[model samples]
Target: MSAKVSAGKQVFAIVKKDVLAELRTKEMVIAMFLFVVLAMVVFSQAFGVILNDLDRVGGGLLWVAFLFMSMLGLNRSFVHEKDEGCLEGLLMSPIDRPLIFFGKMLGNLLFLSIVELFAVPIFFVLFRLEMGASMAGIFLATIFLSNIGIACVGTLLSTISINTKTRDLMLPILFMPVIIPLLIAAVSATGGIMSGEELTEVYGSMRFIAVYDIIFLLVAYALYDYVISE
Candidate 1:
């Protein structure tokens, strides 16, 4: 019998299912956490004390770490789904497709948010860099918008990668080019904010991130059927 679940309920159920599965396995979260931390530490060592000077390119270093870390997290999230054939079952469900998209996105967002939350605080602690009000707000906005962009597109691209022989390496190759605008906007907005630039300076990048999210999310929703059908 088909269950009579609301759209919201279905989405929540999917999100909860993914979250609990991840929590139990703790694979994606732990992998992402360790990957990000290791990346940050390596960056710090490579850049040395230069990163401590917020006057230079500290913000850039942070974003670079995040950008790579996001890739690791995104790939892992979908890999988990693909590994157990869970995604196939999701497609078999009676729930709406967009619900699946949102559910997957929500699950990814949860992990990405957790990674950023922990990573950013540690970044500040290790780097000892303090951000201004505007920069702090921009930092928050970048994480929010970038996560949306990553989740929206990552879900589709991961599906694409799953069908490929090179599922592991294929994701970054396919996903990075597509998400360039997101990275550019996110990096620029973050850079401006960290440099204590005026809000007016970074607003355009913020707008770009917003528009990119809207456009990609819509396109992904429309194309998801095709992606998953294979």
Candidate 2:
């Protein structure tokens, strides 16, 4: 088979396997959902009376909740594969290593997106915030870009973490420092738009996230083979 065809099959197989595993176990969904709701409930109680400015703070809170919740989900994505010894199978495949990274990142993004779809609306309902049209666009764009960043970096880190005595706990310790910039950029962009800032002001933060996405994605692709091997 041609290299391209072989790689394509491997990527598809990885993606399919991840999707089915997630659907059957619902591990990521359940973990993320429970975490999200708990975060919201805690926030609601913390700011119970001061909820007048909820809209102003809503965007930051939403992304903060997502960032932490996603860590839980991303860690689980790799743990499942590791627990089942599937990562070894993937490493033995003839396809390029970058394809494996891309496939895993894609699957992580899909699961995270689904959980956010439910979480975002629930946030609005609980807080009573009006995300204006322009703000809504920026919010969605941030989610997409941030998810890409998270999944790309998270996929590589999970591989590293899985080999440690601390398997799951190691992921956040490694991932949080790397993702701080991305989270800052995402929160700033979302908050700026939600607060009715002009697009020019918001552009800087959005560009930061875009650049982070590109840089981390490349880093993941380059390091993924080594990760799986080690």
Candidate 3:
């Protein structure tokens, strides 16, 4: 019990340190937010007629923005640690490797969610997208579910890429192929919500996302120690 408690505290400490660092530097989060907003604005201007059928296409556009934004954020997730020489120290610390993975993964998740919250309203405004409040809960739930898989898979792969010579280039290559399944489910769920499709299909997509997140979480838990040590 005490061991579990200590591990929990370490994870929270990792998260808190990341939050404080982001507040100070304001680099990663700011860049992600800007990328998302600008992408949408540009699309709206250049593809106005195409965007008219938002209900059908908006979900794809939203995922494209988020997928890239996630890549930007995930690419930077470990920059501070790697550049400041903290990665070595973090690995050497007494905290369990699993804890470090969770800590970093949770931090990534939080930052991504924050950017999404701000970006989505702007997306709604620019695109004139709407859904009944009855559907709002499902809409938000779908996004949050997808975020889990994004954070989970992104963080695990990031640990590998951060140590590479071509870290930036390596991440997308590793991330893209692995992330396709999750992206499909996410787009399906959100597109269903936007199109006011039946609830059952949305629920099915959400379930698949939930399973994907769980599988990745377990994979990360099992492999992080080995991955981070190398």
Candidate 4:
């Protein structure tokens, strides 16, 4: 019980530290927000104005924007720590390494969620899409589940890529393939919701995402210490 409490405190401390630093700088969130908007504009133009097939393609476009925006944010998630030598200091601290992983994952999740809150509405408005009441809940659920998986795997890869000389170039390369399964599940589930499918229709994709989140989260948690050590 005491160990769990200590771990919880350590996690909170790291989260607080990162959040405070981000608030001061406002770098990652701003960049991600702008990138999301630009991607939306570009995608909107490429697809042009769709009259009938919006549901079929909207989900793919939405997740594409999320995928790139997340990569941009994940690439920077560890750069500041590496630049400031904070990564070393944190590693030397008495806190457990998995707690550090959780802290960083949560920080990334928070930033992504904030960006999505703004992005999703803008996406719906720009695409002239409307969601039924029931679909709204499922759409939000899909976003939450997908973000968890992205944050888990992205955090681990970010740590690994940060140590490389071409971290900026290497992160997306390492990140994209690992997240392909997640992107597929997210796009499928979201597309189903947008198409007004019944909850039962999208359950399979939802289950895949949940399983992906659990599996990668555990894998990342187990492997994080080694990733950070080197």
* Candidate with maximal lDDT: 3
RMSD after Cα superposition, model 3: 1.8
Question: Model 3 reaches what TM-score against the true structure?
Answer: 0.96
Write one digit per residue (lDDT tens) for candidate 1, span 51-165.
7566447667776777677777777767767788987787887877777778888888888888888888887787777876756766887778888988888877877886889
lDDT of 4: 0.90
lDDT tens digits, residues 1-230, model 2? 55456777778888899889778888679889989989999988887876677656777788879988988887887776777787787677676888988888889898888899898888888887677776777788878888899888888888788889988889889999999999888887877877777787778888998899999888887887787875
Clashing pairs in 2: none
Deviation of model 2 at 180, angstroms = 0.7
Which of 2 and 4 is the better model by TM-score? 4
lDDT of each: 0.80, 0.83, 0.91, 0.90
Candidate 3 — what's its lDDT? 0.91
Candidates 1 and 4, the one with greater lDDT: 4
Candidate ranking (TM-score, best to worst): 3, 4, 2, 1
Better of 1 and 3 by TM-score: 3
- Number of backbone collisions per candidate, in order? 0, 0, 0, 0
User: Model 3, 1-230: lDDT tens per residue?
Assistant: 34445888889999999999999999999999999999998888888898879998899899989989999999898998899899899888788899999999999999999999999889998888877787888888888889999999999999899989999889999998999999999999999989988989989999999999999999999999998996
Score candidate 1 by lDDT. Answer: 0.80
10 residues in a row with least lDDT, candidate 3 = 1-10
